[model samples]
Target: MEKRYVLEWLDRAINEFNPTQTQSANFEDHRFKSFLKEVMDETARQIAYLKKLAFQYPKKRKFQEVLDLYFSALNNLIDNARLNLKLIASESVISKKALELVLASLADIHTFLLNRYTVSINPDEPLRKYNLAVPVIDFAQPTDNILLSNHPALASLIEDEFDAVFSTGNLANITPRQAKHWKDLNDQICTPEQQNPGDEYFCSLELLLIERNFNSTKFVKYLTNRFTSHMEEYASGNSIEKLAYIQKLFNQIPVIKGLAYDLQHDDLSLTINNWFICEIEFRSRSNTGKGREAPSTATKSNGCIKKTADKVLCKLTVDQLALFFKAADQSKIIAAKSLSAIFQAVAPYLSTPYKEDISHGSLRSKSYSVEGRDEEQLLSFLTKLTRQIEEL
Candidate 1:
C-alpha cells in the first residue's frame, strides 16, 4: 500500500535489471548483473509473500496485482503463460521471456471453467474467489518438516545440523517491498546447517528426483526378482497403449494382492482393519467398449481416486463386483457431462455419511491399482532405497 516505497524498490530493481543510458558503462559488471537478478527474484518473492499474507486476514482480498504478477513471475520461471498474458499483455516483458507452453493449456482450462461457471452462479451464494496458486516446490514451508517430523532419532538429535540444511531465515519478517525465497522462512538461523556426509538434504527437485529414481529402481528390482518379473513392462508410463497393456495385466491377477498384518487385538479375539491402503489406477473404456478412450476421472479433490469408487471392485466379493460392474457399465466417462446423471443414479449407494464440508472432497485417497499399486509400495521401497542412495 506504500506506493512511494514500492516504486523506489521497483525503480532500483528495473535499473539493476537493464541499466539506463544515464548509468555509467562500468555498471555492466558481473556483481551488478547478479545484484539485478537478485532484485528481480526478490521482487517476485515480495509480491508472492504479500499475496499469501492477505489470505491470513478475515477480509480476504488480493491486492489486484498479486495474482497477475504471481502468475506472471511463474510464467517467467517455467517459461509458461501467465493467467491472461495474451489478453492483458501480448507483448509483456514477462510474456516475451516465456518460451514454454506447458501451463498455457492449463490456464486456458481454468479460464474456460471461470467463464463457464461465472454466469451460472446462484445470486444467494456468490462464487468464491481464489488467489493464484504457486507450485508445490515454491511453498515457504519446507516438506522436510512434514516428512521428517516423525523421525526423532536423527532429524531432532542432529538439531544444529538440521537447521543448517534450510538456507533461508526469518520469512515472517519480510518487508512488503522486499523479496525473499521460500527458504527465507527459517525456524532457526545459528545452526550447523552445512552439509556433512550421510546427512544429505533432499530439498531441491534434483534431490527429490534422485530419491524417486532410487526408490523406483530398487522396487523394480525387488518386483522383478522377488515377485513378478514382468512388472517393468506392466508398470510403466500412462500412455494409451501402456494403459491397455496394464489393464490386461491387472485382469490376469485372480485376487488383488495385499499383505495383511495383525494390527489390533480386542477383548474377545481380533479386529482387522485396512490401515495402510495400496490402490491402483487403470485406463478404463468409456463404458462403450472403447479402448482407453475415456480418461480416468476421479471425483477426488486432490486428484486421487476414492477407495470406495467403482474402480476398486477388484478387491470386493463376486456379487459386489457384479453390482459395481453393472453400474460402471451403465456410466459413461467420455461424456463428462454424463457424470451428473450417473451421480444421480448412484446417489443412494455412493459412500456415506453423504456429502462433505467445503474442505474434504473424496472420502478416500488415490490408491489405484491400474498399473497396480505403487504409492505405498514405493514408500516401502524407499527405506531400502535410502540405504542404497547413501552408499552411492
Candidate 2:
C-alpha cells in the first residue's frame, strides 16, 4: 500500500477508537479490544516501515515527509495515553495496557533512530552536524524537586511537555550568551555585600538596581521629598531634630525636586518613607567616620577609633567600594540597608577603640581595649567575617 494511504488509515483508526472513553468493562468486550489492539499493532508496523524509508530514500522529499507524519502519529498516540492515564485515577488492567503500549512505542522510536544515527557516530563530531535524533526537551533533567514541591500541577505539565519534546528530539541547549546573563544576574543578587549594606549606602543602591531596574529619577525624587518632609516635621517639633540637617542636604540635590510629587502620584509614600529611613541610618553611620575614616590619635580613645577605621577599610576592597557607589546611584535605601547589615554583622571585629576626643559619645563609653595578643583572634574573626560576606 502507498505510505500516504497507510498514514491516513492509522489516523482514522486512532480517531475512531477513543482510548480515553474505554473503561475496564470495555476491555472484556473481545471484539472492540481486539480491533483496537490490531490497529495499534498495525500503526507500529507502519511506523517502522516509515523509519526504514527515512534512511533508504534519504534524497526523496516525500519519504522524509511520510517519516515525519509517522512520528507525529506516534506522538499523538503517546499524548492520548498520557491523557487517559491522568483521567483514570484508579489504575486498572486497561490503563496498564495503555501505558505499556505508550512505553513500547517510545522505545521502538528511540531504538530505530539511535541505531540509524547517534550510536555509531564519533563522539568528537558535533551532534548538530548530524540529523538531530532527539529534541532539546529530552536532554534536560526532570525539573528540580523545589519546583515540583512549589507547584505540583504546573510541574506535572512542564514535565510532560518536556518529556514529549525530548522524546521527539525537538529541544536544544542553552546558548553561551544566555548562560552568561544568568551567571551575572546570580552574582549580583546572591552576593553577601549586595544582601547586606554594612554601613555603605552604595551597596544598597546596587542591590536595588540589580534586583529591580528602579527608575533613577524617581528614586532620587522620592529620597529628596522624604528628607524634606522629615526635616519639616522635625523643625515643627513633631519629630527628632537631629535628622533635619540630613533632610536639608537631601533637598539640595537636584534629584529631590519632584520627589514629593512622584510619591503622591504613584502611591509609593510608604515605600518612600521606609527608603528614607534606611538612607538616614546609613548616612548617620557613614558620617560618624567609624566605617569610613582613619581613627584619631589625640587620646587613648583615638587609638581605638583608628583601629576600627583601619579594620573596616582593610576588610573592604576596591571592587566592593565600586559596587557600593553603583548601588547608591540606584537607591539610597538599598545601598544603606545592605551596608548597615554588613557593618553590624562585622562590627564586633571592625569597631575602633573609643578615644575620648574622637569617640561619638555613645560608642566611646562602650568601646573595648584590644590587647596585642588579641590581634590573632581579631584577624581570625575578620577573616571569617569576610568569607561570610563574600558568600552572601
Candidate 3:
C-alpha cells in the first residue's frame, strides 16, 4: 500500500470504531468485545503497512505525516481502552489480545528517529511484556510519576519522539553567515533597555532556537502547560526568586528535564540560562507575567547600583567573588537577607573611613569603585571570614 492510502485507512479505522455502539452499557457484550478485537487487529495490520510506507518515504515532511497518524492511532486506541477500564479489566482475554495488537504497533518506530543505529529501547524487556492494564490507566494521568513508574511504554514513545524531532543525524555545522545570524538573533531578543542580551536573555534565545530549529510547537505547548501548572502551585516571589522557582520546576519535571538531557547528549551547550528562558517564555505567554511581583523602586535602584558596582568589582575576578560568597555562606560568617546585607556586615571592618557613606544601593550594585587599599580590605575581609568559617 502507498503512504496516502495507509494514512486514510488508519484514520478511518480509528475514527470508525465506536465503543459506544454496543448493546450493553459497559462494553461487556461478547459481540462488542469481539468487534473491538477485530477492529484492533485490522488497525494493527494497517499500521504495519503505514510503517512500511513511512520507512520508504524519503522526505521528512511526508515521513512525519505518516508518523503523526501512526502515533495518533496508538494514542486513540489507548484512550479508548482507558475510557472503559472497568469493562477491559473484566474481559481479560479480549482486552489482553486486543491491547497486544496496539502495544506491538507502539514498539520502536525507528524510522521516526535521527539515529536509527542508536537503540534506546531494551530488547530484553519489550513493550508487550508489561501489564498493559496498569499502563493504559497510568498513561491517562498527567503526572510525571506515572510516566517514570508504571508507564514505560508511554515514556518510551515520548522519549523516542523527542529524540527523533531534536536529533541531528550528523554533526550540526554552522557557516560563518549562520554564526552571524545567531549573533543578530542574540541582539534582536534583547530588551529595549539593554542593547545587548545578557546571559539570561542569551539562554532564553537558545531555548527558543531549539524550538525553532525543530519546528515543533507540541513540545513547547506541553512545556508551557506543565510549567504554568507547576508555577501556579509555587509561592509568589520576586523576579529572581521566581526565576529560581522555574529552574527548580524545569529540573523536577520529567519531560522538560528529559529534553535537557537529550540536548546534552546531542552535544548542545547546556547553560544556567537554559532554565531562565522558561521564565521569559512563561511571562510572554501569560501576558502579565503573573506570579512574580514587580520589583519596588528601591530594588530597581539597587540593580542600577549593582551594574555600576560591577565595573570595579570586575577587578576581582568572578571566580574570586564566587569562592568568597560560597565560603562565607557555607561558614555562616554572615547571616543576611541579601548580598547587600553581607556587604554591610563586612563594610565596617574595611579600612576606608568613607565606608559609612557607601549607599546600600552601591553595595547592592556589583559594580563598585574600589582603590588598591580598598581592594586589599575586601580581600582581607574574605580571608577573615574564611578563617572564621574554618574554625567553625
lDDT by residue for model 2 over 1-392, one digit each (tens)? 35355545544433333544544325443555675576567657755674566566656565555555554555565565555555554635654564555445555664565566333333333233233332222222224333233434433443453344234353343222222333343344344454354222223433233133233344446445645665654533333234534433322222311222111132232244334445554544544554346654422332333343344422222222323333443566444444434333344333321111222332222223332212322343446579899999
- What is candidate 3's lDDT per residue for 64-95, written digit by digit as tens? 55554544555565555445433444445554
Model 2, global lDDT: 0.41
Every model's TM-score: 0.20, 0.27, 0.25
Model 1 Cα lDDT, one tens digit per residue, 148-210: 343333333234332332225533223211121222222221123322122222222212212
* Top candidate when judged by lDDT against the true structure: 2
Candidates arranged by TM-score, highest first = 2, 3, 1
TM-score of 1: 0.20
Best-to-worst lDDT order: 2, 3, 1
lDDT of candidate 3?
0.39
**Model 3 segments beyond 4 Å from truth?**
1-19, 22-44, 85-392
In model 3, what are the clashing residue pairs, if there are any?
305-365, 306-365, 306-366, 308-367, 309-366, 309-367, 309-368, 310-366, 310-367
Off by over 4 Å in 2: 1-25, 29-44, 55-63, 89-92, 117-392
lDDT of every model, 2 decimals: 0.31, 0.41, 0.39
**Positional deviation of residue 70's Cα in model 2 after best superposition, in angstroms:** 3.0
Candidate 1 lowest-lDDT run of ten: 267-276
